[model samples]
Target: MTEDAWVPLALSSMIEVGTSAGAVVQGQEIVVWRDSSGVAHTWEDRCPHRGMKMSFGFVRGDHIACLYHGWEYDQAGQCRYIPAHPQLEVPKTICVKTWAVAEAAGMIWVALGAVPPPPAEAEVTALRSLYLDAPLAAVLAALPEGFGGTLAGQVPLVTLDTDLGTLRIGVQPIDARRTALHLTVAGPATPDTLLALATRSDAFRLSLETAGAAA
Candidate 1:
């Protein structure tokens, strides 16, 4: 959130070429996608025109076309073309807000501010990522033990021992029922296996949520 460290938003493999996806980062709805040339970009989900969520739009090579009005936006969040105008150059005000993005450790990293610190070397080999429906406090409390020590290296981490490897889960709570958990391993794990490992997190989250509701 400080724009000093790269927060793992989603797995890189999750966004295939020409595919667009959404995630909640820094408490904002972000849409990220890869261009035809395999470049990645991140932007706020709201379209500047009608405030419609841009994630519902379609991808056309390097731009995403909004579903509401077919507004085309490039990776820089600029409105490049409007099917309605066809001739008018989009005003500079009609651009989607963009964030700094980086792909490392098989994950998509988004920096909220300019000049964010570079992502660590280990994050480049992450195994997988998952989401939780509980607050980060609940998620950390539910960890078996010694799963993670610090978060964001200083934010406090809740490390879990999984069959696949040492599962290091970073919890970013968006709301009561939406938390993005980035799963990294200190050992080897295939993408397939890592996806499977995410299932086990369900039990932990369920227990934490249930107990928290009761309390």
Candidate 2:
């Protein structure tokens, strides 16, 4: 993935304050966590120390600690504390590589490189993310015709006008063989409408996955 493109990692509501979750983009593991102040950060999933998955760690006020040895890293990805040596000052060299993160359109996005394009700015209601085992190209090819909806725009972002409402979709390339669709309503939608959209999305996922397996 190019550093210039911003990829949606998770739904904003999904990653609550003081929590962390694992995500992958093009096969690179990433840890997405929110601080007590509700600011989100993304970093390499590996702990700088013993190479433990940072997503398996716990979150303090503004720090995330690796579960391996209680190694705490501040929001800046700098190791600020070492429980093994409380009195010893932690080395500044111990820090997890971080990526530029942004929240827009009710989703959390991470830019792989330094010069990331602007995040997608749109007023939309969050639906849910759909993970599919099929290739992204196949999913995109099938989306317009499958939903009985009018599809517009291009990959990475698109719009589908359905009977319920217009749905804004952010395409995430999980890897070569997997893809994710971050779904949101383009405008105001009632809970019933959101539920219906979600159900329809689930059916599409099942159909795509089944066809991919057969292929």
lDDT of 1 by residue, 87-193 (tens): 99889889998888887655677777675656554543465465666666666655653232333333323455555566555555565556677767775767777
Off by over 4 Å in 2: none
lDDT of 2 by residue, 129-208 (tens): 88889788899887876765888987667888888889888888889999989899987889998888888988898888
Stretches of candidate 1 exceeding 4 Å from the true structure? 1-4, 123-128, 145-153, 156-164, 190-196
Whole-model Cα lDDT of every candidate shown, in order: 0.70, 0.88
Worst 10 residues of 1 by lDDT: 147-156
Residue 174 lDDT (model 2): 84
lDDT of 2: 0.88
